[model samples]
Target chain A: MNLGILIAGLLTLAIYSFLYKDNPVYRAAESLLIGLSIGYTLVLFWQSTLFDKLFYPLLREHGIWLTIPLILGLMMFSRLTRKWSWLSRIPIALMIGAGAGAAIPAMLYARTLKQVSATVHPLIMENGGFDISAVVVVIGVLTTLAYFYFTREHKGVMGKMARVGTYFLMIFFGATFGYTVMSRLSTLIGRIDFLLGDFLHLLK
Target chain B: MNSNKTRWIIYSTLLIVVVLSYLLGINLITHPSPEVQKSYTFIENLPESSVVMVSFDHEASSLPEIQPISLILLRHLFRRNLRVVGLSLFAEGTAIGYRTLTKVAQEYGKQYGHDYVFLGFKPQHISAILGMGESIRGVFPEDYFGNKIEEIPLMRKIRNYDDILVVISIADGDRTMQWIEYAGAKYHQRIMAGLTAAMITTYDPYLASGQLSSAVGGLKGAAEYENLYGRRGMGNRGMVAQTAAHIFIIVLIVIGNILYFKNRSKGGGNR
Candidate 1:
């Protein structure tokens, strides 16, 4: 018997036992999973970030200049104590400022300008034919933007357009929900496959 | 019927159908999406020995879905004689990426540091991505297994995004968006994503804008990729069970709707 597979299979069964009833076995397995996750994440960060990136660089590779980030990272820990909590804000502000500075132009280009440029194509094609898909997209974009326009009361033409926008929104949400269900089923199939194939060896 | 009883019945039926599907060995037909085809063709067309960066930007929870996609893609990459540099933007995927990489590499009879090398996990994903674009070696001074990156033959030749042919992000969440915005948009590096089903629509804007080169999402996408790759794997097998479950759920939905309508006609509606 493979001890690892046996233990994992049992834990999987314990977790699935919740379907029958919420019991101590299920709770114990859930706690163990959560604990293991936190422990693993902590260890990963300690090795990857705290030790390798910070300490290694500070002591060995880069030397004194690395202390700047180390200090900023240490300041993040100040939030634990009320007396030094104000120090935490310094790093927070710097992060926000730097993050925004980096993100603004990139986000603007990727999310805004490129999107607008792509969407604002000519409704008429080069072959002198009507682009029905472009028409639908244009309508969808206009109506959806109108739906979020809260400056004026939704009345008359605006109301109809917003109503159309709601239809598009519903279609999007339905598609998303459908995909979510498919992904969940996929995950379930994966677990079952493991149990049948690897653990039980019943699968060919 | 009591609601709890109905729920249990549904669960039992699902379990039975899935088990049967597995035991009976059903295979579902899958069509390749244009997006997946684009990704395949791009990699298929890349000249031999081209360096490609594959980032595992997903946590462990979604590994079930993400792993098969990564596995098949890695198979294709290795089959085409591409040199792959693996890394994880999300910390949890570090071990998962390494395991998958090694598994696929062994199948191809590829040696480490020559054919491929895993550069491990990096925190602050945005910063890591930007840093890589500037200098990959500067960001990850050491590979995952504590080897100095400079010592690796593959690492010695690759410097930054300029040397990389494309960046493929296997993700379960929005890390692909960061890759698109920062790496693709800012640095002009080509980007593609193999992601979870739920996040497909979230990347549509990027896909439309050409910021994301292509995306293969959900199990369907994976199955399609398997078809293109011409090898049956977990993806194709999972689809059989998935079809059964979907049909079963639709039947339940139809039955529920009929009952609700019948009750309403009798003026006994409890909706």
Candidate 2:
């Protein structure tokens, strides 16, 4: 009954029509979504990031120290001009350098060292029994690590371990794929619910 | 039948089944998974009036999956009488987070400025995270509504991560990882995540290392939390359709694999 619901329902149907074949309706809806997304993102960026963090402080609070980053940020717009395009690299390089410098120690501790520590748990469980999952994890991690050890040839024992690693890797990939499918399906279900329940009001 | 025709048949069948499941009110009983239980218990046992910072770190595109998690967790946090400080690190999530927080807070009749406040979105995520560790007001001079931070009664008591008991990042991506790396590791703030299912595996290592206190992942995770919270909401309703769809897909996969192997055998060595 609502005009908004009718419009949304028509757009939903238009988008779904793409599964049958591409057409102008679908194309229009797609373009509309893209345009709206860009507009929304631009407004949000200006309000949340540029205006709040940069312009406000610089103007209101006498944040003279903020000018350096502001200039560097403006330099990034040099890419729009062919004559000064090289200026863009300065900001890009600074971003990459700062990102790497900040990420290295964190990644080493969080991603690498912590992960390695988790995998190297004692073979025995806290309850004084054999930890099957722990053993499997240790084997899977070592063998998987061995499979990636391309510096040496995989022969005999190494070859066997690598094959075992392949199986573990396959299992991991399968589980990941399953989870990915579930995630996508959840999104699909959400769209369907919007179409049926919200727009059509066919279900409560 | 051709593959394209077969695909349409499968798609139509799935749509019909899922729709019927929803219409007929086929609710699936969900057992709380260990991870969801861990998250629920952690929040359940928190002392009253303890401050919990919730970061809405997702976009509208993932809202269908992410919204339920955020809603249920917000409900739990509110029900516990915990002071909530909501913020967003992602630009697109700012309005969405604001809406969700406002809605849930109203359900509990929570007063703004005293019970909760939204700090709005900030860019340069790493800087925002580190800044909060030092001083939350220094990072966000004004709340999302442009009210000065010092004027908000809630913000007055909350200065840094030390003032908060926990930080929960509801995210569809690796922004949660940044929370863990910066907030959890450096500042020793307890961190939890409500993540999209696709990101669950990526954060399992952090969960194992106890870096993340707990994680509630995907729709199923939401459903479990809903059960634990004793309220049947969107999550419980969605699970019926999810289960039916999962079964249908598995059946289709098996049939497709069988057909492929059968055709391969008939072709023999020529193929």
Clashing pairs in 1: none
For candidate 1, give fnat to 2 decimals: 0.78
Model 1: iRMSD? Answer: 1.1
Q: Pick out the ten consecutive residues of candidate 2 chain B with the lowest summed lDDT.
A: B262-271
Judged by whole-model lDDT over C-alpha atoms, candidate 1 comes out at: 0.91
Q: Whose DockQ is greatest here?
A: 1
User: What is candidate 1's lDDT per residue for B1-271, written digit by digit as tens?
Assistant: 8889989999999999998999998777898889999989998999999999999998877877888899999999999999999999887898889999999999999999999999998889999999999999998999998899999999998999999989999999989989988998888999989999889988887787788899889888888999999999989988889999999989988998999999999998686
Worst 10 residues of 1 chain A by lDDT: A53-62
Residue A165 lDDT (model 1): 95
Report the Cα lDDT for candidate 2: 0.90
TM for chain B in all models?
0.97, 0.97
Give the Å shift of residue A132 in candidate 2: 1.6
Off by over 4 Å in 2: A1-6, B268-271
Candidate 2, after superposition: displacement of residue B76 in Å?
A: 0.8
